[model samples]
Target chain A: MGRIEERFTALKKEGRKTFVAYLTAGDPDLETTARLIPALEAAGVDIIEIGVPFSDPTADGPVIQAASQRALKRGATLAKILAMTASLRRTSGIPIVLFGYYNPILSYGPEKFAGEAAASGVDGILVVDLPPEEADELRCYTDPAGLAFITLIAPTTDPVRARKILRRATGFVYYISVTGVTGTAAPRADDVRSDVERLKRMTALPVAVGFGISTPGQAAAIAPLSDGIVVGSALVRLIGEKGTSDDLVPAATSFAGEIRRAIDAACPSQGKK
Target chain B: MIRTQPDRRGHFGIFGGRYAAETLMPALLELETAYRAARRDASFKKEFSFYLHEYAGRETPLYEARRLTETLGGAKIYLKREDMNHTGSHKINNTLGQVLLARRMGKKKVIAETGAGQHGVATATAAALFGMECRIFMGEEDIRRQAHNVFRMKILGAEVTPVDAGTATLKDAMNEAMRDWVSSVRDTFYVIGTTAGPHPYPVMVRDFQSVIGREARRQILKKEGRLPDLLIACVGGGSNALGLFYPFLADPAVAMTGVEAAGKGLDTALHAASITAGRVGVLHGNKTYLLQDEHGQVRDAYAIAAGLDYPGVGPEHAWLHATGRARYVSVTDEEAVEAFVALSRQEGITPALESAHAVAWAMKTAPAMAKDKIAIINLSGRGDKDAETIAESREEKE
Candidate 1:
C-alpha cells in the first residue's frame, strides 16, 4: 500500500480520525515550509498536504490565493518543490501530498512529474482543475509511479456521477463541503454529514471532507462524519497573517493541534469491523 | 486538411477537452446535449437566424477599402464590418445564441466574463432582450480601463462584478465567472465570451459565430467573383478569428492568419502573443498555449487593447496553429496604434484597438501581395468605446 493508504490504515487501527494539514510549499519561503512540516507532524497532523503554488489558482479563495502568490514570488517551481520534499523526507515520515492545478504537471510532462514526485517522497497528488473525465493522462503515470492520484467530489456531485468518479479512486475521496470556491463561506455541517453518509455507502475508500471547514469547532463538527478532515485555507490564513516571522510556525502548530485535539476528542473510536 | 470538427470528447487534437472541476462536469455535459439537440432543431435555427437579422443586425457590410487598397498599391483589401452590429462588436453573435440556449434549458439567469467590456455589453444587451437577469464578471483593471463599458453594461441591466484576482485581467474574470456558475449551477447559465473555456463552449460559440465566415464567403464570391486570397483577424481568445475562418476551412487555396497582441515585443515579457512565445499548458479549462512561467503560473500579459491582453488563447486556435492550417503572427502596440489611426483617417473607420492588431497585419501583408489578390480582415469591433484610451495614448505621445 502507498503511504497515504498505510497512514490511514494505521490510524484506523489506532481508533483515530486523521487530521490532514495543508501548507503552501514555498509560502513565506521553502525553508520555512520545510520547518513547518515537522512542527505540523509533531502537532499531531496525520497527513501533510503541500500546495504547489500556481499563477492562477481559480478554485482557491483569497487566503490560499495570496499564499500561492507569495510562494510564486519566491520562485517556487515544481522542481524546487520536489527537491524541498526530498529534503523534508530525511527526518520525517509523514505522508506528503502535493495539491495543485494541472498545468504545472502538464508543463513538467506527466511522466517526468510522476517520476520526480514519487522519487521525492510525495505520497499523493490532487489537481483541482483536472476532474476524472480529463484525469486519464496524469493517472496513467501517477498510478504506475506509486503515487496515489486523489479524487475530489463536491456538493454538486450527484450519486451517479459520484459513483463514476470514485470507481477507480485510490487513497481517499476529498469531499468538497461547499459548492463555491475555497475560503469564501463555511459549509453547513448537516449538509456535509448527509453527503459524507451518502458517499460512505457507495465506496470502501476513506472520504476526507474539506473546503470551508475553518475553525476547530467546525472540524469537530465534521470529524464524526469522515475518515479524515483537511483544513487548508484557515491555516494558510494564519500564515498570511503572521508572515515569514519566527512566530509563524508556533501559531500554525497551535492551530493544527487545536483541530487535531478536537477531531480526536469527537471521534474517540474509529476502527471499523 | 478539411476535417476540423472536434471529436466526441471535445478534443480538438489534444488541445480542447472538458478540464473542469467535478462540480461543473454534469452542467457541461447537460449543456452539450442541449446544444447538440438545439443545433439539429429547425425551429431553433430559424429563430436564431431571425434574431441575427432583425435584432443583432446580420450581414454587416463587406466594404471594399478603396483608399487603403489604393494606398497599399498592391492587393485589394476588404473589411467584413462586424463592428456595425448592435453593441458595436462581434460579441453579440455568441451571446444571443447562448442566452437563447439558456432560455431553452429553462435557465432564468445569465453570467458572462469580459476583458474590454464588449462581451459584457453584448451579453447584457441579450439578457435585456430576453428579459433575463444578467451578471457580468470583469477584471478590476479592465473595469477601470473600460469604465465606459462598465457603465454600458450597467445601463443594459447587468450587475458588473469586478474581479480582483490573478492580475485582474480576462483570465481572472473567466475564473470568477466559473466560480459563480458552480455556485448556482441550477438556475444560471455561463455565456463564455470567447470560443474558449471547456468543451461544448468552444464548439457552441464557434457555431454561433461562424455566420461571419459564411456571409463573407458568399459576399466575396458575389462581388469579387472568387474567394479572398487571405483572411485575417485578431485573436484574443480567438472567437472572432475562428468565426471568420471556420466556413472557409475547406477552401485549400485561401490562407488564414491570426494576429496576436505583441504589447512591447515578442522578446519582452509584456506581450499577449501566446502561440508565438508561450509554452503548451492549460488554463481556463482548456489545454492551449499560455503565457506561463516555467512553474506553470500564468504570467501577466500586456497590450494597448484591453481585449487582447489575455494570457491564453482558445483551444481551437491551438489546434489550428499546431496543424499549420492557419498562421499565427504578432504585431506590436505601436503597429496596432498606427493601424488604428490609419483606418480612422484613410477609411473613415475607427477600429477597436483589438481589431487594429489584425488591421496592422493586413496593412503590412497586403502591400506586398499582387494587385489582383484580395485580402479580407474581420473588423471585430468599433473604436467608440476606446475613444478615451486613444485620447490618453495621444496625450502620452505628445
Candidate 2:
C-alpha cells in the first residue's frame, strides 16, 4: 500500500473523513496541468485522482466527457498520461489514483500497462467500467506489479453486494453518490447521508464520495459524513473558465485552496497532513 | 476426448482473453459461471438440440450439386445448405444458442454487431423469439450497402445504431457493441455473431455451430457410403468454416480448406487474407493473425463482400492453420465475383460474396482433381443482397 492507502487508514481510525479531487491531465494543455497537482495536495485533498483520457469513455458525465474530448483533441494518450504522472511525482508524494476506462488498457495489453503504470509512480487504478469480478481475473497480472485495484460501489448495491465489493476492494471505496448519470448533481443530500451511514456501518474500508458532487457547500456538508468528498465537475468547470494550461499551477492551487478551507471548517481537527 | 481446455483461459494454442472495459467484470463473471453450469447440464444440451432441429430449420440439406460438379469437370461437389436456415444464413445457428444461454442466465437484452447485416438479422430474429429487446450496431457503410436489413431489423423491433469510425465497417461496429456491453452488462447479453472474441465465446460458438459438420457427417455417409475427401468454407471471421471443420477435425480422411478473401489481390492493406499474409496480433478480444502496422495497430482492409472485409481471422482459424489439419488459401475479389456469377447462372443459387470466396476456390481446385474425389462446401449465406452489386458490375463489363 502507498500513501493513498496508508493515510486513509489513519484518517479512518481518527474519525476523520477524506476529500479527494479529480482532474483531467492535459485537458486544455500540458503546461497548465503541470501546475495543478500541488495545489490539490495543499487544498487538503486526502487522495488525488488524475483522469486518463480515453477516446471512448462510456461512463463519464458531460464535464468529464468534454474534458476528455479536449484532451484527445490535444493528442492525449496512455504515454502522455504517464509523462504527466512522472512530472507530478517530483514534488508531491500524495496518493495519486488513476481513473480511466478499460479499453485503452486492453489495447495496450495487461503486462505492459502494469509495468508502465508502476514505473510512472501511480499508486492505484480505479477503472470505472472494470468491477471487482473482472479485476479478479487481472489481479494475478497487475497485483504482482504492486498496483492497487480500487472498486466502485453504486447506490444500487445491497449489503451482500457491498461486502462482496469491500472484500475485493484494495484502496478506499468510491461510493457513487446517486443513482443516475455521473454529471447530474443531487437534489437532496438526505439519501446520500443515509447511504453513507449505511456504508460506514458495513465496511472498514475508507469511503470516498464522488459523482455529481460539486460546490464547497456540498463538500462541507458531505465532509462530516463521508471519509472523502470527491469534487470533479465543478473544479473542472472552474479550470475551463478561469485557468490556462501554461499556468494551471496557480489555477489548481487557488481552486484547491478554497475546497481545502471548506473541508477544514467542516472537520477542524485534522489540519496539515 | 473432447479436447478439454479446462485450466487454460483461451489458448487453443495462444488466443483469447478478457479484453474489455472493466465495468463488464461482474456481468461476464455471471455469464461465465452460468455458461459453465449450462454446458454441464444435459437439459441445456437437449433444449439446444431441440431448438436447432425444430425452430432453426436445421438438418438443412447436404445436396449433391450435379450441375456444379459437371460444370467444374472433376470430383463431385456437395453443398451444406446453411442458406436454408430460418434467417437464410449460418449466423442464426450460433445466435440461437447464445440467446437461449442469455435467457437461461436471466438477461433481457441481446446486442450484436454486424457488417453485411446477416448477423444483425439473425440476432434480431433470435431476440424476437426469446422476447428480448435487441440492439444491433452496424457500420454506417453497411447500413447503406444492406439497407433492406436495416428496415427488417426495425420491423423486428431492434434498435440499430450506426457506427462510423475506423473505416466504418464490421470492426468499428464490434467496438461500438463492446462499448454498449460495458454499461449494459447487467441485463444485456452481447450475442457476438461469430466464433471470435474471448475464451468462452469462441468455445461456445464453435460448439453451437458444429451442428453443420455433425449433420454433414451423417448426410454424407448416408449418400456417398463413405467420408468426403475434402471440406471448404470462406473465412471472413471463420465461423461457418469452423462449424463444418470442427466435427470432422479428428477424421484424418477429411482434408479441410479455409479460404480467405484476397480483396483486389494481397497487397498490404488491399486484402483480407489473414493466414496467407497476416502476422500474429490481437483484435476485438483474441490474439490471432491480423493485418497490423508495425505498431500492431489494426490497418484498413478491403473485400468485395462487406461481410468478409475484416483484417483479422478468428484465433481458432490461426490454430487450425498452424496445426496443419486445416489448409488455408486466398481467392481474389475478381475470382470470387466470377465464381458468384458462374454459380448463380449454372446452379441457380446466388451465394453471398463472403461464401463465394470458398465456392470460387472449390471451382478452381475441384477441376484440378481426378474423378471420384469428393468435396463439400458450406453455402454459408443467401446472396439476395448481392444482386444489385452483381448487376452493376456486369453492366460495367458489358
Candidate 3:
C-alpha cells in the first residue's frame, strides 16, 4: 500500500479520523516551514500537505495567495521544496503530500519531477488544475514511483463524471466542500454529509473533505462525515500573522491541537485512547 | 498545408486541452457535446446564420483602400470591415453565436471576462437581445480605463464586477469568471471572448468568427479576380486573427501574419508579444506561449490598447508559430498610434488601436512589396470605444 493508504488504515484501526495540515513551503522561509512540519505532527496532524508556491494560483483565495507570494519572495522553487522534503525525511514519518498547480510540474518535466519527488520521500501529489482526463502522463511516472496521485471531486461534479474520476483515483478522494475557491466560508454540513455518503458508496478509498472548514467547531461538525478533514487556509492565515514570532510553531501547534480536541470530542466513540 | 483539428484530448500539437479544475470538467464535457450536436443540426446552423446576417450584420463590406494604397505606392490594399458589424467589433460575432448556443442549452444566465470592454459590450448586447441575465467580470484597472464601455455594459443591462487580484487585468478577470462558472455551472454559460481557453472554446470561437475569412475568401476572388498576396490581423487572444486565417491555412501562396502588441520595444519588458518573446507555458486552461517570469508566474502585459494587454496567445497560434505555418510579428505603441492617425487621415477610418497594430505591420511591410501584389487587413473593430483613451494619451504627450 502507499503511505497514504497505510496511514488511513492505521487511523481506522485507532478509531480516529485523520487531520491533514496544509502549509506553503517557504512561507516565511524554508527553514521555518521545515520546523513547522514536525510541530504540526506533534500537535496531531495525520498528514502534511506541502504547498509549492506558484505565481498565479487560480484555485487559491487571498490568504493562501498572500502566503504564496511571500514564499515566492523567499525563492521557493520546486527543487528547493524537494530538497526540503528530503531534509524532513531524515526525521519524520508523517505522510507528505505536495500540493499546487500544474504549470510548474509541466515546466519541471513530469518524469524528472516524479523521480525526484519519490526519492525525496514524498508520499503523494495533488494538482488542483489536473483533472483525471489530463492526469495520465503524470500518473505514468507517479504510479511507477509508488507515489499516490490524489484526485479531487467538487460539489459541482455529477455522478457519471465522478465515477469516471474515481475509477482512476488512487490513495483518497479530496471532496471540495464548497463550489468556490479556497477560503473560510461556512459550508453546509448536511449537504456535505450527504455528498460524502454518496461518494462513500462509490469508492473503497478514504474520502477527505476540505476547502472552507476554518474553525474548530466547523472541523468538529465535519469530522463524523468523512475519513479525513483538511484544514488549509486557516492554518496559513495563522502563519501569516505570527510570521516573525518565535512562537510561530507554538501558535500553529496550539491551533491544530484545538482542532484535534474538537474532532475527538465530536466523535467520542471513535476517539483514540 | 496542415489540417488544424485538435486531437480527441484537445491538443493542437503540444498546445490546447482541458487543463482546468476537476470541478469544471463535467461542464466542459457537456459544452463539447452540445456544441457537436449544435454544429450538426441544420436548424441550429440556419438560426446562427440568420442572426449573423440580420442581427450582427454579416457580409461586412470588403472596401478597397484607394487613398492608403495610393500613399503606400506598392501593393493594392483592402480593408475587410469587421469594424462595421453591429456593436462595432468582431466580438459580437462570437458573442451572438455563443449566446444562441447558451439559449439552446437552456441556460438562463451567461458570464464573460473582458479586458477592454469591447467583448463585455458585445456580450451585454447579445444578452439584452436574448433576454438573458448577463454578468461581466472585468479587472478593476480595465474598468477604470474603459469607464465609458463599463457604462455602456450597464446601460445594456449587464452587471459588471470589478476583479482586484493579480495584475487586475484580463488574466485576473478570466480567473474570476472561471471561479464563477465553477460555482454556478448548472445554470450559467461562460461565453469566452477569444479563441483561447480549453477545447471547444478555441474551436467554437474560431468557427464562429471564421465567417470573416469565409466571406473575405469569396470577396477577394470577386474583387481582385485572384487571391490576396498576404493576410494580416492583430492578435490578443487571437479570435479575430484565427477568424481571418483559418480558411487560408492551406493556401501556401497566401502568406499570413499575426501582429502582437509590442507596447514598447521587445527589448524592454513592456510588450505583450507572447509568440515573439515568450516561452511555452500553461495559463487560462490551454498550453500556449505565455509572458511569464522564471518562476512560472504570468507577468502583466502592457499595450496602448487594453484589448491587446494579455500575456498569453491562443493555442492554435502557438501551434501555427511552432510549425512555421504562419509568421508572427510585433508593432510598438508608437508605431500603432502613427498608423492609427495615418489610417484616419488617409482612408477616413479610425481603426481600434488593437487593429492599428495590424495596420502598422501592414504599413511597414506592404510598402516594400511589389506594386502588383495585394494585402488585406482585418479591421477588427472601430475606434469609438478608444476615443477617450486616445485623447487622454495625446494630452499626456503634450
- The whole-model C-alpha lDDT of candidate 3 against the native structure comes to 0.91
Candidate 3 CAPRI assessment class: medium
**How good is the docking of model 2, as DockQ?**
0.17
lDDT per residue for candidate 3 within A127-213, as digits (tens), equals 998888778868899889989999999998999888888998898999999887887476889999999999999999999999998
For candidate 2, lDDT tens digit of each residue in B195-278? 787657887888889999999999999998999999999998889999999999879989999999998888646888878988
Q: Candidates' lDDT values, in order?
A: 0.91, 0.79, 0.91
lDDT of 1 by residue, B1-398 (tens): 44645888788887989888877888898999999999999999999999999999998999999999999888999999999999999999999999999999999999999999999999999999999999999999998899999999999989999999877988889888988887888789999999899999999999999999999999999999999999999998999999999999989899999999999899989999999999889988888899988767788899889999898999999999999999999999999999999999999999999999999999899989999999999999999888888888889989
lDDT of 2 by residue, A208-271 (tens): 8887777778777777777888888777776776645445566666777777778768886665
> What is the DockQ of the complex in model 1?
0.72
In order, what DockQ does each candidate have? Answer: 0.72, 0.17, 0.67
Q: What order do you get sorting by DockQ, best first?
A: 1, 3, 2
Locate the minimum summed-lDDT window of 10 residues in model 3 chain A.
A264-273
lDDT score, candidate 3, position A138: 83
Q: Sort by TM-score, best first: what order?
A: 1, 3, 2
Please, what's the RMSD in Å of model 2? 4.8
Model 1 chain A worst lDDT window (10 residues): A264-273
lDDT of 1 by residue, A1-273 (tens): 888888988888888888888888888889899899999999999899999998777788878889998988888889999999999998899999999999988988899999998999999998999988789989999999989888999887889999998898998899999888887888898898889999999999988989888899999999888898999999999998888888999999999999988888888674444
The prediction achieving the highest TM-score against the true structure is 1
Between candidates 1 and 3, name the one with more favorable DockQ.
Answer: 1
RMSD of candidate 3 to the truth, in angstroms, is: 1.7
